[model samples]
Target: MNAGKLACSLLLSLLTAQLPACSFNMNVESMLSPPRLTAEQEQIYQKLQNSVGSQQVRLKY
Candidate 1:
């Protein structure tokens, strides 16, 4: 029973240690303003917006 408990605790600790590798940090700036597009991207975006006509279109990267 004691060995089983020890093994469980070790497994839990190892999982906890690995959790940060799968975690991500949020960028407050990006959330607020988002990144700008390159010239080529801008042309494509404009084309998309134009294709949509008066309706609203949004692009996210």
Candidate 2:
């Protein structure tokens, strides 16, 4: 019984640690009006935004 409790506690701790890492807030408007990016940087930024957007959606669900 003690071992089972210990395993459950450890699992919970690991999950909570990961939760903080998943916690993210982005302000895309800050980027929108910023100085222009080089073509390569713009493409990369767009890809990042798309990826983050998807992640945000998943988190909301």
Candidate 3:
């Protein structure tokens, strides 16, 4: 009975020790926003947006 109890305690401690390895810590600054686009890129983006428009066209019966 004592051996069984010791084995259970050992297993529990090992499982707890391994828990931290599965956890993650996220740093806020590491996930900062992306840099802004240049003026020429912005113009191209606007043109693409205008071509797409605000409608969802469908072609099914």
Task: Estimate, for each residue in 1-61, the C-alpha lDDT of model 1 and write its tens digit.
Answer: 9999999999999999988896555888756877899999899989999998999987757
For model 3, name the residue pairs that clash.
none
Candidate 2 per-residue C-alpha lDDT over 1-61 given as tens digits, one digit per residue, 9 for 90 to 100: 9999999999999998887666455788754663667899778777877888855422111
Better of 1 and 2 by lDDT: 1
Model 1, residue 52: what's the lDDT?
Answer: 89
* Highest TM-score scorer: 1
TM-score of 3: 0.38
Measured against the true structure, the TM-scores of the candidates, in listed sequence, are: 0.45, 0.35, 0.38
lDDT of 3: 0.77
Alpha-carbon lDDT of model 1: 0.88
Q: What is residue 42's positional error in candidate 2, in angstroms? A: 38
Candidate 2 TM-score, C-alpha based: 0.35
Residue 37 of model 3, lDDT score: 64
